[model samples]
Target chain A: MSKQIKGREIHLKSRPQGEPTPGNFELVEVTVPEPAEGQLLVRNLFMSVDPYMRGRMNDVKSYVPPFKLGEALDGGAVGQVVRSRAPGFQEGDFVTSSGGWREYHVADARQYMKVDPNVGSLSAYLGVLGMPGMTAYVGLLDLGKPVAGETVFVSGAAGAVGGLVGQIAKIQGCRVVGSAGSPEKVKHLREDLGFDDAFNYKDGPVADALARTCPEGIDVYFDNVGGEHLEASIGKMKNYGRIVLCGAISQYNATAPTPGPRNLTLAVGKRLTLQGFIVSDQRHQHRRPDFLRDVGGWLREKKVKEVETVVEGLDKAPEAFIGLLRGHNTGKMVVKLASGPA
Target chain B: MSKQIKGREIHLKSRPQGEPTPGNFELVEVTVPEPAEGQLLVRNLFMSVDPYMRGRMNDVKSYVPPFKLGEALDGGAVGQVVRSRAPGFQEGDFVTSSGGWREYHVADARQYMKVDPNVGSLSAYLGVLGMPGMTAYVGLLDLGKPVAGETVFVSGAAGAVGGLVGQIAKIQGCRVVGSAGSPEKVKHLREDLGFDDAFNYKDGPVADALARTCPEGIDVYFDNVGGEHLEASIGKMKNYGRIVLCGAISQYNATAPTPGPRNLTLAVGKRLTLQGFIVSDQRHQHRRPDFLRDVGGWLREKKVKEVETVVEGLDKAPEAFIGLLRGHNTGKMVVKLASGPA
Candidate 1:
């Protein structure tokens, strides 16, 4: 006797022109493929929705390839291996893979890494202790190079990477200020994340807010929102300042390419260094051990806090991702699958 | 009884609104001041009129203080000491100081550096072995970091720094391209300076010209003219490309800020680095010895050629400055006061 298992997955229904909508995503059911030799079948537990994924949705040449129409989307996912035909991977083992937005996927064992549930929450693996965490670690410490007593400014403060950036700057013994979309996120940054100051960018002009919050001027700017945020950062930067170009969520949905900061010439007189980077760079793999050791220690010591906004069910993943672009989430936004090995 | 010698100097009659005019400058004569303790009286022979001086005309706070209204502007000048009341300097000694747009001026000995006239031509100190030379050396070597076999794109390539930048990159075994304003200047860059390729920006579209010249994409961009040139360079940069923000002649005259490069977000995907710098930074004081040794050797060996556009008489200094803005000169633009000590 033979049995077949049906699994659900989300596909890109259409390319978005401006802002993405529900119609852009389609949820479909398919027969789960049996694990072949050196492969494992994973039942997804949680999938991540990130700002960078917005770029992937567009058909453009970038560091990573664009998503094809009618194809299942791929991203960070924590899953449980239900069937395995590979060495070092077995049934009931929890692992992290790039088979996100799907209920079940057949992945080669080499493509997924086993996750130790004893470290932190499984959802945290898709967020604070995962890609977003590594981004904040490398962007702030490695690039920004915040020194003790230096003033640090972070845009998109309440989002995944920005939240950790502020906390890490604080840990580096620096003065940290942050800007977020909402008052609640601003409060979360100041009170929960231990930022020195926080402002709701929706309330006033970014330059005015930065000027008011950081009187001495920013020595390091961790740019996440870009556009006006980048302009404001340049206007407020001190001499020899460093700008870590992490992400530009503000212009992600633009149908046309947005203009850069008009005050970029200020970089000349101020002798500023603006460096753009991606987490997938080889330096990341080289520095991951140090990040795991230091940030892991900070997490265990309660010096840093983790936050996640979870959406239940695979059908809600599209809504979760769309809401993420709208700044609806307080921290890392993850979609929780209905069933797993547990 | 002693007759006082009159000193002729050019003063800023009015701050320019956009493009400078002859009316903005006033030539006046004043009695030459005597050299006090630790001071020297110099009879100017040659003075440099550079693009960066335009930024000083505006009443804005920058790395260097703005030029005061109705005052003789100061820049790199080579002069012979007519009289000296300070140690380590004597009459007829050729020296360099920030005393420009004047026939005669008084300077503190500490503000002047004694130049060995035997090392190179007296004007050579103002071009090849001076600020322009050091600017080319430091900006290309330290900031731009053109590795051997990399492609370097230089804007305003026939100008003081750009010409030298291309030659130095060639010395480093790089494929170098340049963009100048006129066909004559383009010919100078390719024919005289030995750049691998060059284009006349005024001929057609900068993007098209860059695409034609930089087939493999620009690995290092020495930005001298900003706005369109900077935009085109950004569009053609290779992954991990470096931009040395040296000068921005294109925007220095604008009454309003122009739009920046529209495709700055490409930096994120390409992992590009754009750094702005000023030659006056302390790093120069430290690296000056190395610059002098290497560039001086190159100059002595005739491996590099020096060119200067001499606008005779102090009265033509304003014309020289305005012509410089219009990209009239083939190389370093200098105003000749008269023959030096020789």
Candidate 2:
């Protein structure tokens, strides 16, 4: 006999014009169906609310499809496989999947990746030991190619991926400088994250701050916030610099098309290379094991830290996401689901 | 005893605020110095007037030094050795040197490169076989990296470097499309240059023209004209496309800071790469012999054609340069100096 469970889920009520609002989301109670032939039912413990989620609220053909209107929103989440009909899975297995924005999910067993809690905490699997961690590893090492003694300038350095990028750069023996929206985040980047230098972009012009903080021009720039920050980075880049275009959280919510960096002409004279990427691309996915080995070791050694801002419930995911876009959270923002037995 | 010679040279009367004018130049007659112990005297045959020269007039730190006021301007030119005091050089040898905007030059023998007249025309040494040709060869092959059956889009395709880029892309088995300023240049690009499609950008919006011309979207974009054209190219680029930033003739004369492509955010989802270079960089210069072998063979086999707008007399050099910036000439713009014995 199958046991029916009632769970809370968040759906996209409507699409936002620019910046999202809580009204655009709806939380409702739903019946969790029994696991079909090759499927399993999951009890989500923690779900991610990220800056990239803002793009999904708009109707456009992107690397990932837009969130469907009037349906449950989905993203990275850690859950317990409470029921299983698939051969490779069993009841009470800890797993991670794109079954977020909900308390319980019913999906194919293939959708979930089994995580060993002995390796790290459940929330760490969503933050440092997960997608954001992998993004930092692939972006800084594979793309940025930072070598020892090279200076790396990271924007949004207090955020999930940016924070890890600075720490990883330090591990690579690089001189790391970062910019964040607030003084507190800047302080956190310097004091907690171990960035060589940090600045509040809101305090003064990014160009002036960059010049002052990074006396020698940047050899690599990790761009998480685009627009004026990107322009300023280009101005401060040394010859043959590499720019990793990881995210443009600053322009994601703009109602109009934002103008790019005007000083791109400098790229010609300086022979710079600017490249963009999506973390899920197969080329990057191949590096996941190596990412785990390196970042996992660092975490265990306490050389790298995992920072998170936890919201109380699934009903608060929309506000958390909106806050993420507004730079409200200092690091990875996650919504905590019901605290229950595994 | 050394023979004295009177020669005419062009001097920078003043730096221009925006678009350069003929008033900024002054042509003067001066005595050509006799060959020193290790120097040589040469009579100039032809000189190059390129879009890059505009940057040197702005009095800013760049890849090349700015043109000093009230001094003879120097650039790429082919000349005949009239007198020599160095062992390697002989009288009547054709050489290429930075002796442009003058009738004669006196410099150390090491400052010139001996060019074989049998390989190409004396003027060709200043155009197809010289700096412009090397730029297209290195930028397209190294940076763009077009594979067979890919589509390559080129802006300012009727100009010196761009024209070679389209032809070289075709040589690499790519479908080539181009954009030019005038209808006549468009016709020349399609009918004479063997481009698959060509559009006059002045006809309408660059976005509409690009969408219509690049039906399958672009795999490679050789950007010679920046601003709107660059913006349009980014909109039409396929996933993992490459953009080679060569020149920005469109923005060189802008009195104010020109805004960049507004769609750079698309680069992230599409995984685009935008790289810029200078041909004179030692790394690119290392490819010179390979460039000559391939492009020189193409020239001999008639697979590639070198187009030039020949401006007669050194007096017309200033006007020709101004016109070069305004898109008044198709292909390479070069000034033919006095016609004399080699």
Candidate 3:
């Protein structure tokens, strides 16, 4: 026990008032705890920062429980097992687990899934081959159900989950249109990601951009940013269009009740289906095999590209998360707690 | 041809800018043209006026085509066949057909269904046994999918489709709650229609009314009046709730677009499904046999009660339709075009 080291963690210092600020997070030091029977101790290499975490900072009830003040905030992270007291796991093996925002976490052997470096990069396990990837996979294929000739529209198109959605739709032989916050992000969508069309929503009204891009109307909409983006997509939706309500980053910071899309009534006349979902609810569907098999092959073949905004140091997670909410990141935003194995 | 009589019809005089006025309709006398070969001439006994007609009054695109200016509005009607050139239909037979804003209509014999008056009343064919009835059946059973003991909330609960929705839900063993415009409508929903609870939304905020009525939360919400009713229903929805988007009469008359339910983002966390459909889409899924057998049995056994607000004369149809949009009627609003044979 005396040979154990010390580690640091980011805690939820205080709940935010509208939008979060630096004051909401606290960094504290703690002794690295030993792995119990059937548990393993791991050193986190990378931890994800996402828009959904913003909801957890609030004291209200939500799909995920609120982050408690004075306690470490937990989320998705990739780590290497340093010590094992469990079956089928050994030292130096990389695994993905939740309860991250910390340098070290003692997890039950089954809490993390062992990752294969031969399959993909270690960090890719936290982004493309992980939760975000699965979300895009299930939400698009199961709910959006885009056909080969259909036109699909996605808000937050250059984002973690959304980027994969657009790419998957393209692979499925659909024409894709994307909306992003910056011109560079838009360029990434078109020139890099091969979207049929892309628009910078910040430059103009979303409805106008959608009209110009989706002249034939949208058959499916993958919604990550809500509010105006959602409304515009609905306005341009064709008969029997499908909307996958995955996230709504646009309304997360709203102090007052945000207005919903005005044109939702179009659903009735168009016979549209708007389905809202949380990725965790569908985890039992065992879509990981398809995600890794398809996405891993695409990664190796360079058919799919991974975009990331990496902020160095564990202390930088708060800034990365806040930046993500502001659409400052072009893709998956992660805080690097430690460097890769030398 | 010698016994043929003249009939007057109401035409769409002009597209209404906002709310429809009497000037929007033009009543004119037209000669009773003789039925051609394989056609039937019928004297309309009763005709229906529904909220969806308001959309037709506009010159914009919708699920149904816009009513052409100077052309008679067409909708559900029941009549007695006066003459027939077809084999199936006979003189004095009762039938139901579309294209009914006139006192008498000439139609291909196949265009109308020869309806038996033994199952239900002739007017019930225009409401509880006709299009509105089918809408209630499909939207609730097919989309809403309520289970036994679940709480189902219905808006515009005393209206034609909504009334049948509550009764059908009750028969399915659900705890039904309803909201209506008037105290009398609410009383009828509770005392006569057997709703578990009822509220007059005209008396207070819809959110408060829903909270009071649905203390345990709503499982299935059949949305009729879209604005606040839809918003309030979303707030009280349970996990995996299903919302049947039936109508949005509250927003139909607005010159500008109406705001959707702001809390719709709750769908992500609650995993709610909000599906909008036109009754016509599910028509091929003919529920007619089930409707006639079950609803007829309910009517005969006195488990269900039917209500109608009758306006005498086809000349008064414009007012009847206008009043329906204003929530001026309880249950089905029908216009008496003529009386049947003595």
Candidate 4:
């Protein structure tokens, strides 16, 4: 017999023209969904706020579908499996899934991955041990193809993906440099993240900063914030350099057509390759085990440090998400719905 | 013994402000001397006038060196080895080398490749079997990676590199479409070169032309004239489409920065990979045999057609070279030296 329970849900009220305001989101009380055949009912502990979500907020066709108005927005989340009707999942197990911005979600059990609590914190699975970590690993290693002694430049260095990218590049014996928005974030990148150098992008011209840090030229550039950062990286790229376009947080909320570097002619002169990627396209299932093992080892060894802005209560998620867009959060931005055992 | 021979040489008198004028070139009488210890005396037969040479005429740093004023402008050419002190070359041997705008010159034997008459015409080596042919083969196959049944769009369809790219893409079982400046070139692309469809780019807006021809979004865009054509291709490209940037002939002589498509944001939305390449970087000695064999077979089977505007005499070389920049020539534009046998 299915049990009915009350759940807190956040729905899209309206599409934002530029920067999303509170009016765009609606918090509502709803009956928790019951698991159908081969489904699992989960109680979410933490929800992820990502830059890529901005693309979904707009009514535009992209790699992923746009978020519908008056519907619950869905993304990566860590939860406890309260009930299960599938072979793989059982009650009381910790898991992660593309669950809605809700206290409880009923999803196909196959979509939810069981997490090992002994390895790390359950929230860490939503950030470093999850999709964001895999995105950084495959995008840089497979596409960027960093060789030893190469200079790797990463934008949004303090974010979940960028922060891990710098650390991974360092493990590969690359001279890793990064750019973040604030001095505090830059300090974290240099001190804790093991970046060879870090710069505050807001301080001065990015090209000048790149010149000072990367005297030779950048061999690979992992672009998280596009527009001017892409232009600056283009100017300072070595011959045959590869640019991994992970995200463009800089232009996500731009009301007008974003003004970008018009000097794409440099791509020809420099013999550069600029590739845009969606993490889902990378075939995560086959790679997930290896990724978990590798990144898990790095975390345990303290080679890769992770920082998170843990927003308490699901009610504060929209503000935390907005804060992420404004570069106010360091590392992974995750909203906590419950007080943990600690 | 050092012997002197009379030859006609064209010198860069001044750099052109916009479109290079005939006044910029000064034809002068020069003494062609004998080969040094490791050099060969080559009697230039047919010289190529390619778009990439335009970049070398300017003082700006490029893949190759800038053209020096009062010195003979150099480009790829088919010639006959008259004398050789180097072990690799011999007298009366047909070869391809970077022969300057001159009747006869002493070249390093190491710099020239011996052309086989059994493969194709000696002049074909200057266009189809040499740099331009390799450019199409490597750039399209390596960068574009056209799969069977994919739609491929090419700009500058009648030019040396573009013409070959369309045919090569077709050979790979791709549905190939191209854009040319004239009706004759358009006809050549469709009727002679085996392109699935072709259009006159000068007739109307490229986006409109692309929309009409490419109902299925472009899988690969081989860009030779990158201005409006590049922008149009960007709009038509499918998800994960590959853009092989071979050259930007349209923007070479641009006085002001050519205002490119402001909608480069489409790159992220479509997840396009835009790459630029120079053929020399990908070339290795081992690849030449296979390249010549495959491209040579296509030439002999008449699956591919080679066309050229053979301007008579070295004195006409500068005019032909300038004509190439203005899109005055069809296919490969070549200057025939008076001192060589036809």
- Going through the candidates in order, their DockQ values are 0.84, 0.87, 0.87, 0.59
Compared with the true structure, what per-residue lDDT tens digits does model 3 show for residues B1-342?
A: 566577899999999888899999999999888898899998899999999999988888898899999988999999998888889888999999996899888989889998889978899999988888888988999899999999999999999999999999999999999999998899999998999999999898999998898999999999998999999999999999999999999999999988878898999999899999988775435777887788888989887777889999999999999999999999999999888842
User: After best superposition, candidate 4 residue A295: deviation in angstroms?
Assistant: 0.5
lDDT of 2 at B161: 90
Comparing 3 with 4 on lDDT, the higher-scoring candidate is 3
Question: Pairs clashing in candidate 2?
Answer: none
Q: Can you write out model 2's per-residue Cα lDDT over B1-342, one digit (the tens) per residue? A: 465789999999999888988999999999988889999888999999999999999889988999999999999999999888998998999899998999999999999999988877788887779999999999999999999999999999999899999999999999999999998999999999999999999999999998999988999999999999999999999999999999999999888889988899899999999999999998887799998999889998888898999999999999999999999889899999967633
Q: Please report, as a residue range, the 10-residue window in candidate 4 chain A with the lowest summed lDDT.
A: A279-288
Misplaced by over 4 Å in model 4 are A1-3, A282-284, A340-342, B1-3, B86-88, B282-285, B339-342
Q: Which sequence of candidate numbers ranks them by TM-score, best first?
A: 2, 1, 3, 4
Ignoring the other chain, what TM-score does chain B have in each prediction? 0.98, 0.98, 0.97, 0.96
Off by over 4 Å in 1: A1-3, B1-3
How does residue B281 of candidate 3 score in lDDT? 74
Interface RMSD of each: 0.8, 0.7, 0.8, 1.8
Fnat of candidate 2 = 0.89
Give TM-scores of chain A for all candidates: 0.98, 0.98, 0.97, 0.96
Assign candidate 3 its CAPRI class.
high
List pairs with backbone clashes in candidate 3: none
* Residue A16 lDDT in candidate 2: 93
A1-342: candidate 4 lDDT, tens digit per residue:
565788888999999889998889999899876788899888999999999899899998878899999889999999898888999777888988899488888888889888898777888887889889999988898889999999999999999999999999999999999999999999999988889999999999999999999999999999998888888898899999999988889989988876555677778879999887777775546777788899999989988876788998888989988899999889999999865311
Of candidates 3 and 1, the better by TM-score: 1
